[model samples]
Target: MASNDNDNSLIAGALFLVAGGIVGAGVALLFAPQSGTKTRKDICRFARKARRSAEDAVEVVEDFKDNLSDIVEEVGERATEILETGKDMAYGAKKKLLKALEESGEQLEKQRAKLSKLVG
Candidate 1:
């Protein structure tokens, strides 16, 4: 979710930058004492640069998304492995506890029988 938020923020920031650049360019053109031909050329050049920048931003996002996916998958796999290892350890511990309890009960039974004969 945090990654998603960051992605959204990056996209929003890129869009804002592009929008601001275009607006600034337009204002500059309007205030400058340039002919129509020069202004048109300038606008065209700025548009091309903007398009490239937008494309670069998209590529950046794509790479980030791909890297995030790879990281998520790796973490998921590690979590699964850790869970399985914990289960195996728990099972081993349980078996040991049960064996110890059985041995203890048998010893108690033997001691009780021995005491009963002596008491009788």
Candidate 2:
């Protein structure tokens, strides 16, 4: 949980820095004394750069999501295997206990028969 909070804080800090840089660059470009055509070209270039940056961030996010999904699936499969193994062990133990009880009962019956014959 602490790691998650730290990750969130790091992401927020990075986003804040990127946003500040973008805002500063826009303000600088707007105030620069340049011809109308050059200003328009500069604005278009900046917009293209920003779009590329956004696309890259999206791709990174998508990849992270895919990796996280795979990790979750693997954990779920491991948990299921562990659960099945536990059930099998329990069943084996129960069978062994029942067999022991049956053997003990047979021994007891034999001793009872011998004792009765001796008394008669």
TM agreement with the true structure for every prediction: 0.77, 0.63
lDDT of 1 by residue, 1-120 (tens): 887888888888888888798889888987889899999898889889988988898789779888988999999999999999999999999999999999999999999999999998
Give the C-alpha miss distance for residue 52 in model 1, angstroms.
1.0
What is the lDDT of every predicted structure here?
Answer: 0.90, 0.81
Clash numbers, per candidate: 0, 0
The parts of candidate 1 lying over 4 Å away from their true place are: 1-13
Worst 10 residues of 2 by lDDT: 6-15
Looking at model 2, residue 98 earns an lDDT score of: 100
The deviation in Å at residue 117 for candidate 2 is 6.0
Task: Score candidate 2 by TM-score against the native.
Answer: 0.63
